[model samples]
Target: MQGRLPNGTLIAVKKLSSKSCQGNKEFINEIGIITCLQHPNLVKLYGCCVDKNQLLLVYEYMENNCLADALFGRSSLKLDWQTRRKICLGIAKGLAFLHEDSAVKIIHRDIKGTNVL
Candidate 1:
């Protein structure tokens, strides 16, 4: 979900999907790992919370939404080759950071269209 802070900072709220059965410990660990990394191509995790036993992640909002939406949505907008190349490069850089450059190496459990923005 997209929302604004009291100070008017735009943000994206990610509520852990019920479909995901990750325990609280794992969730907290993931949050910690994410908070330790910073990259231009990676989404910035602003904060996290366990409110009423529900996990929530606050992140910097992307104005254009996810890559999957741009590729498959009903919108008629078309991306030129240059734009597509940039997106691919960005994804590569982000993945490289997670896999090699970060303090701790990470093996992304899932790589799907909707997961990339």
Candidate 2:
């Protein structure tokens, strides 16, 4: 879900999939973790929604969306080797920050090309 703030800042809203069965604790923890991290390669967490039946996380929008969409979507856009390598490097840097440089070590439970942007 893409949206813009009143100040015109673009953002992507992620709703915790009901299938994940994530409770409020997980949601709050995620927010806390995200807020504590500071890295260029990682998406910025803007805020979150915890209203009634809603559990949404707002993040900085990636103009290119995700890697899966670019690779599998019905688009003719072709990425060169350099672009792909840069994406991989960015992912590596982000993971390294989470797993090594951050104050709290974070082991990402799931990682997929679709999760990259």
Candidate 3:
């Protein structure tokens, strides 16, 4: 869902089932890793909240959704080769930053079109 914090920053919140332990861990890990990272291409993670059993990830709203949505959805045809290349480069740079720039090496473990956003 779309929401705004007290500071007036726009955010997109994704709700996940608490029953999936793996999913919850990935969600928490992604939030933790992304919140400490900043990049022009990667989606900016603002903050997150854990309310009892619910997990809320607050991210800067992207005008466009995930890379998978742009690559395979109805709007897929709209992204030209150049745009696709840019996306690929951006994802690579983000990954490089995670591995080389950060103090601690992080293995994304899961990297896919959807996660590229």
lDDT of 3 by residue, 10-58 (tens): 8899876778666655677767867888767667878777777888777
How do the predictions measure up, each by TM-score? 0.86, 0.87, 0.79
Model 1 has an lDDT value of 0.84
lDDT string for model 1 (14-94, tens) is 888655788878888889988878999888998888755688999998876677877896445578899889889988899
Overall lDDT per candidate, in order of appearance: 0.84, 0.83, 0.77
Instruction: Tell me the spans in candidate 2 whose CA falls farther than 4 Å from its real position.
Output: 19-21
Clashing pairs in 1: none
Clash tally for model 3:
0
Better of 2 and 3 by lDDT: 2
Question: In model 3, where do residues sit more than 4 Å from their true spots?
Answer: 22-33
Q: How many residue pairs clash in each candidate?
A: 0, 0, 0
